[model samples]
Target: MYRILIADDEPMIRKGLQKLVEQSGQSMTSIRTAENGFHALQQIQEERPDFVFTDIRMPKMDGLELCRQLAELDSDIQIVVISGYGDFEYAQKCLSYGVKEYLLKPVSKKAVHDVLDKLVRVSARQRTDTFVPVSRLEQWIAEMDDLVWSLREPELELLLEKLRKELHHYSLKLARFCDVLEELNLLLAKRLSTRDVFSLQTHLDLGGARDVEEAWSRFAEGIWSIVRDLKARRKGRAKDPVEEAKHYIEEHLAEEVSLEEVAEYIGLNASYFSQLFKQSTQETFVQYRTRRRMEKAKKLLQQPHYRITDISGEVGYADHPHFTKTFKKYTGFLPSEYRQNLGIE
Candidate 1:
């Protein structure tokens, strides 16, 4: 649920916004009002609502000055200015404050709802860090499969673990994660054994990964060629059993998560899955999950709307210190430091 603060001198305007926020849905719980910008700042300091709606013209401090002061306090605070005057200079000043969006006074309920919807969408995308399209995960999975097929026993174990951690941390699906692994295993054990070097080259010619897109196509074509060669020598590919396991990890990141539990989710024997996963990704599943959780913690920390405790839980860290330790290991800065730097940048 989101906490909202409405700061307007007019009693009627404040009541109207309060009712509108309630009517928006159950996602909003705490709704507070301040008669002026000064009170608004004090309420914000004490409560720290996720969003603030204030009238540009207020007693003591105007919305522009209030936003300026609020940014000094917490730059990440979302401010929407509401004023009947609609001065261009005031609106221009808001951009400097990093206000996400602004609203003119004579506030319409529809306008408020529109802004809220936009905020939710931005928040959701930011949470996922879906910077790379969801489609890209499949490609990375394919690349992991190819890399795994060419490696020997000990080396394979190390690589697989690394891949597993990266996948889990990034929240890639288990089925997709496992499918590429399985495909590589099948190709390496069977195809690579009997095929000659020239024969393997012929295979690469099919979807020659010559171009940038094809080079990083995220498919097992390049790896399948090696498997084709090994299989001819009567070397058979090992079947990847961890396909279902990766999906389980991603779906349950917020819960009590561990490699053993992840293995159990896909009905795999724990020790075997751990070994195979390590062989394929060159990382332990635990390391990858922690890395990812910390990344999320970093992003969430950058948003002032979320407290450290909430961020800890949100990113799958059981304790703040633990989260802090892992976060610093991955990014050199504590979560709070990372956030503070982000504001300055």
Candidate 2:
């Protein structure tokens, strides 16, 4: 017994659709009607209907805008857009917002019944198929963040494919999909800062995309562009082994990075690279790594949500006691005392 809303500009059409839906003998609990998209949005907010039948052209807001707003508010609600033949392409674009069906002008009783029947079947399937747990979603987002920061072309393409599959499989609305993109953007900004990668803020405008596919395409392109720019920057700069080692250290702060590994990566002897690192940074490799770990640990401590153990692991200390000792040595206070002193708890 799903609640339904029919929004159209004309009174006769609204009445006709309402009557048609009632007479269709569908499993509907309530039937509501509105004269335009704005009024329909109001009804939706108040009633939280399960399905919406809206016209393409309406006052204050069009069907597409209504669909977009509705998706942001509630992704679970199903939308069926009604449009004339002239607005067919526009109606097609509304599908990106997770519209279930598109009905052309002068919709017949049979068409309404067929759409309702299809909705019932689709809803039934979705009940089982599209129920992604919060933990799984978080895992996917974390994996995506890792792949983006890896800056490998093959992995990037795999991520794009995964995104496309998730978009279809989860039936993600524009809002949720945009949220995924936003998380990726944040990860890019955080990880690429070591190499001075360009800002992706302008390119992450998912709201301005014409459709979901366009948004995804733009996002993929932006990732590729970033990868290319990073490569170009690396190539254009004269090889500075010490600077390269520093960038590598910054990027791999969580890893158990060693001077030998970095020296090998930069095609330099370990002893020579060690001297160069100490000379350039005014600190030995071990001291620099410790300082970076302590600095990151302090920043993580400032956030109350981060547990001391979690912060310890994040900064590459597997043993909690060791991390506490190191933190105290660097900041003159244990992580807990530091947080308490700052009144973070």
Candidate 3:
């Protein structure tokens, strides 16, 4: 449901817009009204509605000026100009500010309904189709709220892998997006989400981000709210013990380790941990660790500077025969076969 703000100097016009929004077929949760632009700006700053409808000619500030101030505050806020026919030029100017719709007064219920319909549909598409969630697109907000955050290369890599699982729901667009995300650094990666693009662009346009770290914190928080909610929905929990285990496995891929030892470290019994890990990650602990080792071995094999035995050992295998057997079991080929397939001499 979209939240709407109505700003008109005339009480009847404001009330009429609010009634149109409430009676419209589309869902609109909240309606706030202000008699003038200054009051409208105050209300907007406080509540931050999804859609704003303001008359172009008001006593205190007017719709165009209010729209300009809102653009300064957040480029994402949608503004709809309620204007007289003579105010076409003013409405045209507000277009550069990203106003959603403009309706001529005396406004009809149908006209307001049409504007609300467009706002709801466009907003919904932007929310679902975009990489970032609509509500919490600011990373700093999520960080301050004590949500999960990722910025460092290794942490971001882990996040990308998790996002892969998430992309199953949005697979069509996610393929290209995930590829782009794979190569982006912390700041660039945060900016990749289309929902943040406008706001970040505005931030860059104004001046240099003096408190980049603080801004990053806010942006990370926003990303986390989406991921955390999705994680909660699919997994039925806010925290995933399996994800924790996967992180440990990735960190320790080069060390000789076993599920039993990992279970001991985390204070869970081996059998239970194995079940939960498989449930969360869709791979058993043994399979996950073995795959990590194979991935590392593949990277090392590409070097050609390292012997197979040394590479296998470097990835936690002590016995050459056992390592080859497990690698073949997982990859459907021996280590040499994998290297040869890559055309590596």
Candidate 4:
């Protein structure tokens, strides 16, 4: 029992879209049409429809303005914009105002049906409160972190496959799906100690990704490329000094290790090592060391036998207040709070 409204100056275009929706066989309590954005706004105020489809160019107000108004009035209302090739820029602006879908002019029946199907699925999920939770997202990030750290190619592929299925099942909005990909990118970058040279924004061409399938294909390819590059580099002839540095850091987690100390251990000058480390890893030597220490602290916090002060010292933090502040910043939880969440006494 959902209400839908279509707004367009062109009578034929409005009628065609209405017919297309009706022909798609999706259940709707009512289907209304308006001649322009002003009329559409009036209709929306009188009866807030669950969905809106408006042409970019209308009489009183344009689709972009209409979208802005609707967003302010009701954040939950799903909006789809109808635009021509010339309105491409306007369409992108509409997205920022919470328009969920866009249809190019000469909209095909198949495209309309596809958009409707996605809206229906998303609406159903909203009703059921089935969106992916924050805890589940964190769990996924942790699993990805482990996979990247281990450098297990097969396992990583399997994980990506499962992730792809989850993305499809959720039928998330394009922006939300991209946000997840960005998080995965950052997690992999940090774990691999590599700079994010392959960000989705710069590396992947996802502008044409109208559906989950298209977007995921490009995203998966980008991830696979990163994996392949890392494997090839690992097997390359030159020994990786960054890997050696990481090993030294791990071994000296309980001690204060300086850049000069690690550089001397790896037989490189301190200044050269600092630059090389940043080039190989996205983070500087100090940032990497701090992250490793925080990760170790998280693990130790899970053990009830370890006192908070002892754990802090074990991870190179001599000051208890400093340790608590750093731990809270790193994990969004104080050490004690983290342990309590784990049910560890």
Best by TM-score: 3
lDDT of each residue in 95-126, candidate 1, tens digit only: 78877687776677798888888776765554
Q: 1-345 in candidate 4: lDDT tens per residue?
A: 678999999999999999999998898989999999999998876666778999999888988889998777666678988999998886899878878798998999999999999988887776556456766777776787566544666887898889888877876665456546656665555644443222222255454344456667877787767655544544432245688889989999989999989876665557767887998898999999999999999988888899999999999999889999999999999998999899987
Using lDDT as the measure, name the better of candidate 2 and candidate 4. Answer: 4
The reply for model 4, stretches above 4 Å from the true place, is 130-345
TM-score (C-alpha, index-matched) for candidate 3: 0.43
Residue-level lDDT tens digits of model 2 in 13-71: 99999998998887887999998889888887555676899999999888999999988
lDDT winner between candidates 2 and 3 = 2
lDDT of 3 at 242: 63
Model 2, residue 332: distance off in Å is 87
Compute each candidate's TM-score over C-alphas: 0.37, 0.38, 0.43, 0.38
TM-score of candidate 2 to 2 decimals: 0.38
lDDT of 1: 0.63
Return the TM-score for candidate 4, rounded to 2 decimals.
0.38
What lDDT score is found at residue 184 in candidate 4?
61
For model 2, give the RMSD to the true fold: 17.9
Question: Quick one: best lDDT, which candidate?
Answer: 4
